[model samples]
Target: MNPKWWKESIVYQIYPISFMDSNGDGKGDLRGIISKLDYLQELGVDVIWVCPIYKSPNHDNGYDISDYCDIMKEFGTMDDFDRLLQNMHARGMKLMMDLVLNHTSHEHPWFVESRASKDNPKRDFYIWRKGKNGGPPNNWESYFSGSVWELDPQTDEYYLHLYSKYQPDLNWDNPAVIDKLHEMVHWWLKKGVDGFRFDAIAHIVKKEGYPDAHNPSGATTVRAYDMFSNLENVHTLLQNLYDKVLFHYDIMTVGETSGLGPEQALDYVGDGRRELNMTFQFEHMNLDAASPGSGRWDVVPWKLTDLKQIISNWQTVLHGRGWNANYLCNHDQPRSVSRFGNDLYYRIPSAKMLATFIHMLEGTPYIYQGEEIGMTNIALESIDDYRDVETLNYYEEKRQQGVPEEEIMSAIHRKSRDNARTPMQWEDAHEGGFTTGTPWLRVNSNYAEINAANAVKDPDSIYHYYKKLIELRKKHKVIVYGEYGLLLPDHPEIYAYIRTLEDQRLLVILNFFDKEPVFELPADMKQGGMQLLLSNYQAPKNDDLTQLKLRPYEARIYLQQLEGK
Candidate 1:
C-alpha cells in the first residue's frame, strides 16, 4: 500500500450550517465551528472536512456555489474562515474544503454573464444549447426533478443543470472554463487550505454528444444519468486537474464519486494514480436504494449480508491498489443508526455497533457530525419542517401525481437529506444548544436526551466510545494496513470481520438488529488468545470462547492474540 498521512488519518465531516451557530442568526457559521475546534480535536480526528461554506444562494444549501473566492455572508467573513483554519492547524488537524467545480449557482457571475447573450465572453462557460422543438435541449431529467435544461428567454437557450435550475452545470469541455477552474483551485491552495473534496466529481465531464437519455423508468423526463455521469472524459478531466493544480500542493483530494461501480472506481483513485487520494463509493448505501426491477422511487430494506458483501468487495478489490472512505452516513444520507441499526429501540448500543461496522474496516473512516452522539433521524410533523430542495421537490412532484401524503412523508422521513442536516445537539437546552435563536432546521426532538453535554458526562457514552475508536486507529497499524476478511458473510444479523497483518489479528463483530444473535466462534477462529479490546456493553462476559452470546445491538472488537505473540 502507498503510505500517506490520509491513510492513517480519521476524517470528521462538519455540515457548516448545522454544526454550530456562533451568533443567534439561526444558522451555523465559521465562528461556531471555531468554538468547537477543541471538541473535534478531543474527538481524535486528524482532519476536519467542512461542507461548503462558500457563498451560495442556499438553493441546494451550500452545494450551489455562487462565488468561489468569497465566503457566504451568513457564514461570516473570510477572516473567520482564516481563524477556523488556524484553529484546526494549531490543534494538529488538517482542514479540507468542499470544491464544487462541476456546477455553480445560477446567480454566479459566470452564469450571469453567460446568460446575458449567446455571444457573451463567458457564454460558453456553462452548458447552453438552443431548445429542441421548443423543449429542453435533451430529455435528461434534473436530479431535483423536471427537465435538466432551463430556458433563458433573453438568449432563448437552455442551460444544463443536473441538480437544480438554480445550479447550472459548467461546461467542462470549454478550455476557458478549465483554465478558470485551475486558477480558482490554485488560489485556494495558496490560501493555506490543506485539500479539497471535489463535489460531484464523476459528473464533471459529460459525453461528447448532447444525447437524449432514454426514459428507463417511463417517467415524464429521462432520469438515467448514464449520458452525463461517469463518462469516459471524466478521468481525463480529473488527471488534468491533478496536473494543473493538485500536483503543486501537498494536499489530499477526495472526490465525491457517484454513478460508478467498484471496478470503475479504480481508474479514479488508486495508489500512484494522480487523480485522487480516495473517493466515496455509493454501492454500500445503494443496497437500500432502488435495485433492479424496483421502481424509481423504491427504497428497499437492505440485507445485512448484502451490505457486508458490497463493503467487503470494495475492501478486497481496492486492498492494495486504492483507498476506500469507510462511512455509514454522511451529510446527504439519513442517520446510520436509524437506517441500518435499531435507532428507536436500541439507539446507544446500536450507534456504537454501527460505528464499529465502518470505523474498524480496512479504510479511512469518516464520522459525520452529530453521528457520535447517537442522534436519531428527525421526526418532522409535516413537510414544512424540511428545507432541503431535493426533498421538497420530490414531495411536490409525488403529491401532484396523486401519491398519498402519508406515504410521501414516510419516504421523506426515511431518506430526507435534512435528517442529517439537523443542528448539532450541543446540550439539552432548547434549540439543542446549537443556536440562541431558532435553528435553520428543526433539531431532532430527541436531542433533549441525546445531547453532547449528556454524552460527554457519561464515561461509556457513544461520544467517548468513538473517541476511543479513533485513538485505536492512531495506535493500531493493523486496523489501517491489515488485510480484511469477512467472518460471517452469510449471517443475516451479524456483521463479522477479521483483519490480519503478519502476527496481529483483530476481530470485529456487530449485531445489527435489536435482538440477541448467537455469535459462535467460527471454526477457523477457534484458537484462543482473544482478548476483548472493546465492547459496547457495560460488562462483557465471555465464559465460553467458542459459544458466545451477543446482546441486542452488541458490538465487540477482539484482539486475536496477546501483544507480543
Candidate 2:
C-alpha cells in the first residue's frame, strides 16, 4: 500500500466560534485563530479542521450556511480569512474547512429563489414535495426533533429539512446541484485551503419511496434514519462525487457519516476508492447512547468493553479496506475527559490515559480544541443557559409532553450539544480568558482551574500528555500506517493491540478498569527484547517486560526489538 500523509498526520479541529475571541466583540474570529497559530504549531498538529465560518442566520450555528463564498461577519471578513490561511500555511499547517452540502439556510440566495415560486429555475435545487393528505409531504422527523418536512406557503409544497426548519436539504439527485458543489470544492482548493470535513455527509441521499418509519418505542417523534439511513443511492451519489470532484484535488476529505461502519463505509473511503481520504464514524462515540437505536438525549452507563469493541472493530476492519478518523470529542460531543475518563477525581491521569488509548491507534488522530487542557463537560443547572437549537427544541417539546422539567434537565445535562459548544478556556479570567465581555455562549464553570494557560505551563498537565502522544505519532509512521491486530480479544477487562509495519512491531496495552490486570504476551510477541516507547501511567523500563502488568487506566506502548529485523 502506498503511504498516505493523512494516515500519519495528527489533525486538530478548531470550533471557530469558541476557539478564541480576538476582537472584544465577545465572539471568536479569524484573527483569533491567526494569533493562535503558534500555539497550535507547538502542539504538534499538522492539519487543522475549522467548523463553518460561512455566512448564516445562526439557526444551526454556522452549519446553516447562506453563502459558501462569503465569510460570516461575526467571524470576520474574507480578508481576515485569507490572512488566516496564509498564516497557517506559513507555519507549515494545512487548513480544512467544514463543507456542509447536506443543507443550507433558507435565507440563502438559492433557497430564496427556490422558495420564491415553484416555476423558478432554482426550485429544483432543493427537495420540495407536495403534501399527501393536506399535511406534511412525509412523516419523516427532523434530526432536531420536529417534522422533517416544512411547509412552504409560497410554493404550497413541503421542503425537506433533516435538521432545522430554517435549513433545507439540497436535492443531490439533480446534476445542477452536483455541478455547483464541484465548483465550490474547486473554489476553496484554488484559494489554498487544504481540504474539507464534510458535514452530515451520509444524509446526502434519501431512501426512495420515502417510506414511513417504524414508530420509536418511547418517543412521539419518528426517526428519519429508519427510512433514509444507508439508502441505495447513497453509494451511487458518493461515487459520482468522487469521480466528479474529490478525486481531482490533492487534499484530504473526511465524511461525517452518522450511520456507517467498516462494511458499508468501504465503498466511500476504501483504499484507492477515489471517494474520500477517510470517514468519521460515530460508532464509538455513540457507545453511551441512552437507548440502542433510539435518539434519547441522555447518557447511559458505558463500559470499557463498549469502547474497546468499537475501536477494535474499526481498526481491524479498516486495516486494509478503509481508514478511520480517531477522535474522542468534537463540536457535537462532550469533552473526552468527562465522558471517557474520571474527570472530577482522576482528571490528569485519566486524561492522559484516554489520550494514549486513541492516539496510539492505527488512524489519523483529531484533537478537538481545548481537549489538550483536560476540559470536562459543562454542568449547566438551568436550561435557560443552553444555546443550541436542538437543546431548545427538545426542552420545549419535553415541556409540552408533561415530561417534568427535572427529567428534561437531566437529559440536557447528559446529552445537550451546548455542553461542548462553550467558549475555549484560555486562562483563569472573568470569562475563562475566552472573551473580554459576555461570550456568545457561557464558559464552563470549571474553567478557572482548567485553562490553556495553566495546562501548557504544568508539566503533568493533559496538554503535555497530548503533546507527547502527537509527537510519538509523527515520529513513528507505523502508528498511523501499520496494520492493527487486537491481542487478548476476549480478555474481559483489558484492551490490547499490536500495530505492525514491515519489520517494525509495536504493542499498545491498556488496563481500562481501575483494578490491576495482567496481559499475557501473544505467541508472536514473546520472543524479543522490548523497550517501552511510551506509557500513560509511567514510561516503561527495559527490564519490565516479563509478562506485562497494568494498573488502573494504565496504558503503555512497547517497541518490540525483533532479532531478525
Candidate 3:
C-alpha cells in the first residue's frame, strides 16, 4: 500500500455555526473558528473539515450557496477566512471546506436569472422542466419533505430541488455550468485551501431523463434515491474534475456518497481513479433505520451484529481497493454517544469505546465537533426549540399525516439533525460558553456535565481518551494500514476485530451494550506475548486471554506478537 498524508491523518469535522462564537452575534464565524485553533491543535487532529462557510440565505443552513466566490457575512469577511487558513496551517493542521456543488440557493444570481425568463442565457444552468399534469414535472420527492419540483411563476416551469425548494439543483450536463464550477474550485485552491468535502456529490448526476418514480400517489415525502444517486456519468464528471484542476494540487477530497456500496465506491475513490481520496458511505449510518423502505424518522433498535457486518464489509472490501472515511456522526446525524452508546449512565465509557472502535478501524477517522467530549443529544420539550429545516419539515409533515404529537416529538428527539447542531459546549457558563448572546440553536441541556472545559481538566474524560487514541494512531502504522479481520462475528453484544499488518496484530474487543458479555478467543488465535495497547478501563491484572468478561461499554486493544517475528 502507498502512503498518503490523508490516509494517515485524523479529520475533525466542525459545523461552524455550532462550533464557536467570537462576536456576540450568536452565530459561529471564521473568527470564532480562528479563536479555537489552540483547542483543535490540542485534540491532535490533522485536518479540520468545516461545514459550508459560503455565502448563503440560510435556508438549509450554509448548504444552499448563493455566492460561490464570497464568504457568508454571518461567518465573517474573506479576510477572516484567510486568517483561519493561515492559523490552521501554522498549527500543522489542514482545512477542508464543504463544497456544495449539487445545488445552489434559489437566490443565486444564476438561478435568479434562470427563473426570471425563458430566454435567459442562464436558464439552462439549472434543471427546468414543464409540468406534466398541472403539477410537478414528476413525482420525485425532496429530501427535506415535499415534491422535488417547484413551479417558477415567471418561467411557468418547475425546477428540480432534491432538498429544500430554496436549493435548486444545478445542471451538470451543461458544459458551461461545469466550467463555472471548475473555475470556482480552482479559485479556492489558489487561495491556499487544503481540500474539500463534496456535499451531496452522489446526487450530482441524475437519470437520463426526468423520470417519474413508481409512486402513484406522491403524497408522502419518500425519495427514490436510485433515480439520481451514483449514476455512471458522475465518474466521468469527477475524472474530468481531477484532470482539469485537482491534478494540479496535492490535496485531499472525500465525497458524500450516500448510496454506494463497497464495489460501487471503487469507481470514485479507488487508487489511481483520479476522482477522490475517499468517500463517505452511508450503509453503516442507515443500519438503525426501522426498515429498508422506512424513512430516517422511523427509528428502531439496531443490533451489534448488523453493525459489525456492515462495518466489516466496508473494511474488508475497501482494504486495498479503495479508501474509507470512518465516522459515526457528523453535521447531518445525531450525536454518536446518544445514538450508538449509552449517554445516560455510561456516557464516558461508551464515548471512549466508540472512539476506540473508530480509530482502530482501517481508515481516516473523522471526529465530529462535540464527539471528543462525549456530547449527547438534546431533548427539547417543544418542537419550537428545534432550528434544523429537516427536523422542522418532518414535524409539520407528520402532524398533517395525523401522526400523534408525542410520537413525532419522540422521533425528533432520536433522529433530528439539530441534535448535532447545538452550540459547542465550551464551558458550563451561559449558553455553554458558545456565545454571550442567544445561540442560533438551543444548547444541549446536559452541557453542564459534558462541556469541553471539564473534559480538558479531567485526565479520564472522553476528550483525553480521544487525544490518546489519536496519538496511538500516529505511533502505530498498523492502525492505519492494517488489514481487518472480524472476530466473534455472531456475538450479540460484543464487537471484536483484529488488525494485522505484517507481524504486528492488534485485537480490538468492544462491548457494544451495557451487558457483561464473555469474550472467548477463537481456536486458531494464540494468546501468548500479548501486551495491552489501550483500554477504556484499567488494565486487567491477569494475562489470560482465553476468556474474559467485559464491563458495560468496555473497550480493549491488545498488541500480540507472532511467534518468532
Candidate 4:
C-alpha cells in the first residue's frame, strides 16, 4: 500500500459562510477561521477543506466563481486569506481550497465578453449554440431545476449551464480555456495552497452532439447523466490537467464524481491513472431516494442492507486499485445523525456509531463542520426561511406542479441542502455564537442544547469521540491500510466488518437501529485473543463474542492478536 500523508489524514470541511463570523458582518470570514485554528487543531484533523471563498455574486453560495484569483469581499481580502493559510501551516495543518473548474459565473469577464458578440476573442470561452425550435438546444434539465440552456437575446444564442443559469459551463474543448484554468491553478499553488477539492468534476465534458435525453417518465425536463457525466474525453482532459499543473505540486486532489460507480471510478483514480488521488462518489449518498434514479428530494426509507452493499462494494473494489473519499454528509447533504441515525432518541450513541463506521473505513474520512458535535438537520417553519438556491428552486417547481405547501416543506425538511448550511452552533449565546449580527440563515432552534462549547467541555461528547478516532488512526496503520472484510452481510440490523493487516485484525460491530440486536460470531473468527479497543456504550462484562446482544445505536471495536502475538 502507498503511504501518503493525505491517505492517512482526516479532512474537516469548512463552509466558510457558516463556519464563523468576524467583525459582526453576519458572515464567516478568514479572520473568523484564523481565530479558530486552535479549535480545529484540538479536533485533531490533518487537513481542512474550506469551501469556495473566491469572488462570487453569492448566486450559488460562492460556487459560481467570478474571479478565481481574488477572495470574496464578504470572506475578507486576499491578505486575510494569506494570513489564514500562514496560520494553518504554522499549526501543522494543511489547507485545501474548493476548485470550481467546470463552470464560471456569467458575470465573469470571459463570459461577459463571450456573450457580447460572436466575433469576440473570448466568444468560445463558454459553450454556446444557436437556439433550436425557438427553445433550448436540448431538453436537458439544470441540476438546480429548469432548463440547462438560457437564451441570450444579444447574439440570438443559448448557453449551456448544467447548474444555475448564472453559472455557465466552460468550453473545455477550447485550449485557451484549459490554459487559463491551468494558470489559475498554478497561481494558487504558488500561493502555498496544499490541495484542491474539484467541484462537479464529472460534468466537465459533455457528450458529442447536444442530444435530447430520453425521458421514460415523460417529464418536461430530463437529467442527462450519460450526456454530461464521466464522458470518454474527461479522462484525457484530467490527464492534461495532471501533467501540466498538478503533477509538479505535492498536493491532494479529490474529484466530486457525481454519476460514477466503483468500476468507472477506477478510470479516474486507479493506481496508475494520472487523474486524481481519489473521488467522492455519490452512489451511497443516493440510496435513500424513493426509487432507483429518483432525485434526492424524493425521500424514502433507506435500508441498512443496501447501504452495506454499496459501502462494501466501494471498499473492496478500491482496496488495492484506487482510493476512496469516505463521507456520510457534507454541505450538500443533510446531517448524518438525522438522516441515518436516531437523532431524537439516540443522538449521542448514534452519532458516535456513525462516526466509528466512517472513520474505520478504508479511506480518508471527512468530518463536515459541526458533525463532530452531533449536529442534526434543521426544519425551518416556512420555505422563506431557506436560503439555498437548490432548495428554493425545488420548492417553486413542486409548488407549480400543484404539490401542497406542507408536502413540499416536509420534503425540504428531510432533504434540503440548507439543513447543512445553517450557521455552526458555537455556544448557547445569541445566534449560537456564530455572529453578533443577524445570521444569513436562521440558526437551528436546538442550538442551545447542541452547541460546540458544551461538547468541548464534556469528555464523552461526540467531539471528543471524533478526536479519539483520529488519534487512533494516527497511532495504528491497520485503520488506514488494512484490508476490509464484511461480516454478517445479510443481517438486517447489524453492520459488521473486519479489517485485516497481516497478523493484526480489527473487528467493528454496529447496531443500526434503535433496538437491541443479537450478533452471532462465527466459530472460525473466535480463535484469537480479543481486546476491546473502543465502544460507544460501556464495555460489556462478558468478553465472549459468541452471541453478543448490542445496545441501541451501539458501536464496538475489538483488536485481536492471533496466537497470543
Candidate 5:
C-alpha cells in the first residue's frame, strides 16, 4: 500500500476544556496548550486534534457552535490558536481541528435568520416543516430523546434538531449551505491546519420525507439517525466535498460515523476515492453493555476474544480497500482502563497492553487526553458532583420515568459523560495541577497517584509505553502500511498477528489474561530463528520459542530480517 503521512502517524486528541489551565481561570485555554507543546512532542505523536474551540453556548460542551469563524472567548482569541498551530508545526507536528458542521447553536446569526418568517431566504438554510394537526411537524426523536422538532414561536413551524433543542441541524440539501461549509473548510486550511475531524459527518443528509421508524424500543418517535444518516445521497455530497475541497490538499479528513457497517465504511474510505481518510465506528465501544435495550448500561464482564474480534474484524476489512481510526477511548467515552480492562488488578500492564494493541495495528491511532497514564473513571459520590449535560439529562429523565434513584445512580456510575470529561490530572497537586482554582469539572480522586507529571518521569510508566509505541510507528513504515493477518484466530487469551512487506516481517504477540498462559506457535509461525525486538514484559534469553510462557498482559514485538535466497 502507498504511504500517506497520516497513515504512519498517531493523533493525540485534546479535549481543550479539560487539558490544562495556564491562567488558573478554572478552564483550559489555548495558552495552556501552547505551554504544553513540549509535553506532546515527548509523546512522539504526529498530530494534535483539538476538540471544538469555536464560539458556543456550551450546551453540549462546545459541540453546539454559534460561529464557525470565531474561537470561543474562553479558549482565547484566534491569535492564540494561530500560535498553537505555528508552535505545533515548529515541533514537526500537525494540527487537526474538530469540525462540527452538522448543527449550529440557536444563537448563531444563521439560525437567528432561519427561525424568522417562513418566507425568508435564510429559512431554507435549516430544516423547517409545518405542524401536523396543530402539533409537532413529525414524530422524529432527538438524540437526547423527545421530539426532534422544536416549535418556532416566530414562524409557527418546527425546526429539526437531531441533538438538543438548542442545536438545529443544518439543511445540507441547500447549495448555499454547501458553499458556505466549503468556504469554512478553505478558511481553516488557509490557516495552515493539516485537516479536520468531522463531527457527526454521516448526518449531513436526511431522508427527504422525514419518515418514522418502527424501532423495537417502544419508541413511537422516528429515530433521527434513520432520518439523517447513511442516506443514499450522503456519499455523493461527501465525494463532492472531498474532490473539490479536501482530497487535493493533502489534508487528513476523518469522519465521525455513528451507525456504519463494514460495507458503509468501505464506501466512505475506499482507497483514494475522495470521501474520507478514515472514520470513527462505535461497534467496539458498545461491547460492555449488559442488556440489549436502551437505558441498560450495567457493566458486563468482557472476554478477551470480544475485543480481539472487534479489532481483527476492522483490520481485515480495511487491510487494503479502506482505512480505520483505531481508538480505545475518546472524549465521548469513559477511559479504557476502567471500562475495557481491569484497572485495579492489571492497571499498568493492561494499559501498556492496550497501547500495544491499538498502536501496532494499521490505521491512525487517536490517544485521548491523559489516557497514557492509565486514567481510570472517576467515582462520583453524589449525583450533584456530576456536571455533564448528558448525565444530568439522563438523571432527570430516569427520575421522571419513575426509575429509582439507585438505578439511576447505577447507570451513571457505569456510563457517565463525566468519566471522560474531567479536568486533566497534570500532577499530584491539590487540584491535580489542572488549575490553581477549582476546575470547571471536578478532578478524579486518584489524580495524585496517576498523573502526567509522575508518568513522564517514570521510565516504565504507561506514558512511556505509548511514547515508545509512537516512535516505533514513525521509524518503521511496515507497521503503518503492512498487511495485517490474525495468526491465531481461535486462541482464547493469546492475540497474535503478522505484518509483512516484501521480505521484512514483524510479529506481534500479546497475552490478554492476568495469569500466565502457555501459547504454542501457530503452524505458519516459524519457530527456529525469530529475533525479539520489543516486549512490554521482561524476556529470558534462550527461551524456547515452540512453547512460550507469556506473563499476564505481556506483549512482544518480533522482527525478522529475511535475506534473499
Candidate 6:
C-alpha cells in the first residue's frame, strides 16, 4: 500500500462561504478560517479542503470562476489567503484548494474576448457552434435542465454550458487553453500549496461529432449529461497533466469523477500511472437517486444490501491497484446524519455509528464542516431562503409542471444542496455565532440545541467521538492498510465489516436503524480472545462475542490478535 502522508491524512472539508464570518460581512472569509485553526487541530484533522475562494460571479456559488489567480473580495484579499495557508502549515496542517476547470463564468476575460467576435483570437477558447435547423446544435441539455446551447445575439452562434447559461464550457481543443491551465497550475505549485481537488473533470473531454444521445422519452435526465463525460481522451488529459505538473511535486490530486464505474476507475487512478492520487466515486451517492429513466424528483427506497454491494465492490476492486476517497456528505449533498441516519431521535448515536462504519474502511475519510457536531437539514419556510441556483431552478420548473409548492419544498428539503450550506453553529447565540451581521443564508433553527459550544463542553458529545476516531486512524496502521471484507452482506439492519492486516483484525458493526436487531457474531470471530476496542454506547450489552442484540444506532469495534501474535 502507498504509505504517503496523504494516504494517512484525514481531510476536513470547509464550505468557505458558510464556515465562519469574521469582520461581520455576513459571509465566511479567509480570516474566519484563520481564527478556527485551533478548533481543527483539536479535531485531529491533518488536512483542510477549502472550497473555491477565487474571484467569481457566484452563479453557482464559486463554481463559476471569473479569475483563477485572485481571491474573491468577499472572501478577503490574496494576502489574507496567504496568511491562512501559512498558519495552517505552521500548525502542521495541509491546505488543498478546489480547482474548477470544467467551465468558466461568462464574466471571465477569456470568455469575454471569445464572444466579442467570431474571428477574435480567443473565439475558439470556448465551444461555439452554428444552430442546427434553427434550433440548438443538438438535443443535448444542460445539467441545470435546459438546452445546452445558449444563443449569442452578437455572433449568431450558440455556446455550450453544461451547468448554467452564465458558465460557458471551455473548448479543450485549443492548445492555448491547455497551455494556460498548465501554467496556472505550476504557478500555484510554486507557491507551496499542498494539492488540488479537480472539479467535474470527467466532463472536460466531450465525445467527437457531438452526436445526439438515443433517449426515447426526451426527458431531462442525468443519463443525457452522462453521455458527455468520461470520453475517449479523459485519461490522456489526466496523464498529460501528471507529466506536466503533478510529477514534480509531492501533492495529492483527487478528481470529482462522475459517470465512472469500477472498470474506468483503474485507468484514472491506477498506481504508478502518473494520474491522480484518488477520485470520489458517485455510485454510492446514487443509491438514493432515482431508478432507471427517472430524475432526481423521484426519490427511491434503497435496501441495506444495495449500499453494501456498492461499498464492498469499490473497496475490493480498488484495494491493490488504486485508492478511494471515503465520504458520506459534502458541499453538494444533504447532511449525512439527516439523510442516512435517524436525525429526529437518535441523531448523535447514528452520526457516530455512520462515522465508525466509513472511517474504518481502506480509504481516506473526509468530514464536512458541521458534520462532527451532528447538524441536521433545515426546512426553509419559503423558496426565497435558498441561495442555490439548482434549487431555485428546480422549484421554478417543477412549479410550471403543476407540481404543488409544498411537494417541491418537500423534495427540496430532502435533496437540495442548501441543506449542507447552512452557517456553522459555533455557539448558541444568534445566527449560531456565525456572524454579527445577517447571514447570507439562513442558519438552521435548531442550532440552539446542536451548536459546537455545547458539544465541546460535553465529554460524550459527537464532536469528541469524532476526535477519538480521527486519533485511532493516526495511531493504527491497520486502519489505513488493512484488507476490507464485508460480513453479513444480506443483513437488514446491522452494517458489518472486517479489516484485516496479518495478525491484527478489526470488526466494525453498525446498527443502521433505530430499532433493536439480533446479530449473530460470525463464527470465525466467536473465539474468546477478542477485545472490545470501542462502542458508541457507554456500556455495550454484547459482553461476549456470541449472539448479540444491538440497541438503536449501536456501533461496536472489536479487536483480535492471531494465535502467534
**After superposition, which runs of candidate 6 have C-alpha atoms over 4 Å from their true positions?**
219-223
- Which has the better lDDT: candidate 2, or candidate 3? 3
lDDT of 5 by residue, 1-565 (tens): 8778888888999999999998888999999999999999988888999999999988888899999999998899999999999999999999999998889999889989877787777898999988887778777777777788898888788998888999899999899999999999988898899999999888988887876666666655755566677787888999988877886688898999977766679889998677998999887776776744243255676666776787788888888899889998988888887776668988998888878888888889999998889988887878899987778878887899899998888878778878988999889997899899878989988888999999999998999888888888877877888788887777788888888777777788888778777767666556336877677775554356678888878888877765661
**Model 5 regions lying over 4 Å from their true place:** 215-218, 222-224, 290-299, 540-542, 562-565
lDDT of 1 by residue, 171-230 (tens): 988999999999999999999999999999889877677887766667658766778878
Tens-digit lDDT track for model 2 on 289-364? 8776667486678877777777888888887777888998888987787777777767777788878878988878
lDDT-superior candidate, 3 or 6: 3
Name the better of 2 and 3 by TM-score: 3
Q: Model 4, which residues run further than 4 Å from truth? A: none
Tens-digit lDDT track of model 4 for 1-565: 8888889999999999999999898999899999889999999999999999999998999999999999999999999999999999999999999999999999899999999999999999999998788788888998998899999999999999999999999999999999999999999999999999999999999988999999898876898888999999999999999999999999999999987789999999999889999999998898888876678899888899999999999999999899989999999999999999989989999999999999999999999999999999998998888999999999999988999999999999999999899999999999999999999999898999999999999999999999989998898788999999999888999999999887889899999998888888878888867888888887575567898888899898888875654
Of 4 and 6, the candidate ranking higher by TM-score? 4
Worst 10 residues of 4 by lDDT: 536-545
* Residue-by-residue lDDT tens digits, candidate 3, 244-295: 9999999989999987789899999988899999999988888888887577
Clashing pairs in 5: none
Q: List the candidates ranked by lDDT, beginning with the highest.
A: 4, 3, 6, 1, 5, 2
Cα RMSD, each candidate: 1.7, 2.0, 1.2, 1.0, 1.9, 1.2
For all candidates in order, the CA lDDT equals 0.87, 0.83, 0.91, 0.93, 0.84, 0.89
Q: Estimate the overall C-alpha local distance difference test score of candidate 3.
A: 0.91
For candidate 1, the lDDT comes to 0.87
Q: Estimate each model's TM-score.
A: 0.97, 0.96, 0.98, 0.99, 0.96, 0.98
Shift in Å, residue 403, candidate 2: 1.7
* lDDT for residue 167 in candidate 4, whole number 0-100: 99
- C-alpha positional error of residue 41 in candidate 3 after TM-score superposition, expressed in Å: 0.6
